[model samples]
Target: MVKQIRAFNQLKELALSQEILEDSRTKGVVTALYEALKSRDAEAIQKILAPDLEWWFHGPPSHQFLMRLLTGEQESDFRFVPHSISAFGPTVLAEGFDQSRSIAWVHAWTVTDGIITQVREYFNTSSP
Candidate 1:
């Protein structure tokens, strides 16, 4: 019975350590992504994103259009500021507000192997 308890404790410790490691890696990827976006550095963004990354936008077509502008796919002067950040499992979420446009947005990112593999973004669909 004592041996079984010892083995179970070891397994629990290993699982906890793995969770911590995953959380750290997720934070690193999301931090790099946020910095790249804030600077509008396409090269930096590309470094942290997987080559086959797909980003989904939840809103009207107008929101998708705005995302293109924000990501530099289309020419625009708007820049987003991330005000809050949180993580769950393999996903990191950022809440941002653009005071000039009076808009708030949420971006959810799925990070794997230290790279952002998927992104889901929601524009100002909720009242502040």
Candidate 2:
């Protein structure tokens, strides 16, 4: 009975450790992506995102600047300043306003294996 209990406890500890490690790895990727966005570092952005990344924007269709930034069609003149960031398992949510531009944005990211595979961005349309 004693040996069985010890074995179960060891297994539980191992599972917990693995979960923490994955969380750390996911946060690292999310943080790096935001840092790259702030600096407008195209190379860093490319490095952190998956090659086959899928991103969507929710706002007026007239607002094409954000899409341009993501597709590398145009350079970003705005810098996003995240006010709050939270991680729920492999997903990370960042909400803030742009310091360089008058835009409030909420970014939801899905990270897998240390790479951002999906992104959903919501921007305030009231801002010019």
Candidate 3:
């Protein structure tokens, strides 16, 4: 019985450790993407994102700022500053609000193998 319990505990610990490692890695990839955006480094952004990236957006069409940024059509005055970032498995959720514009935004980023494969953008909406 003691040996069985010890083995179970070891397995639990290993699972938890793997989860933490994945979370950290997910956060790192998302952070690097944001840093690239902030710097307007198109080359870096391209490297971080998959060539066949998938994107989705909700809210007003005019609120597609991230799309514009990715496409090199972003306005000079607009910026996305994520105030909160959380990672769950391979997905990262980044939320932020622009006080000046009263715009609340959430980005759900799906990363695989250190490359961002998809993004779902929400504007003026509560985080899910």
TM-score for every candidate vs. truth? 0.81, 0.76, 0.94
lDDT by residue (tens digit), candidate 2, 43-108: 999889999988888976655565677687876566667788777779888898765566688888
Residue 103 CA displacement from its true place in model 3, Å: 0.1
Kindly report which residue stretches of model 3 are placed more than 4 angstroms away from their true locations once superposed: 125-128
Highest TM-score against the true fold, candidate: 3
Please identify model 2 stretches exceeding 4 Å from their true place: 1-3, 62-65, 99-102, 125-128
Each model's Cα RMSD: 2.6, 2.7, 2.8
The CA lDDT at 49 in model 1 is 87
Q: Give the winner by TM-score: 1 or 2.
A: 1
Ranking by TM-score: 3, 1, 2
Clashing pairs in 1: none
RMSD of 3: 2.8
Candidate 1 vs candidate 3, lDDT winner:
3
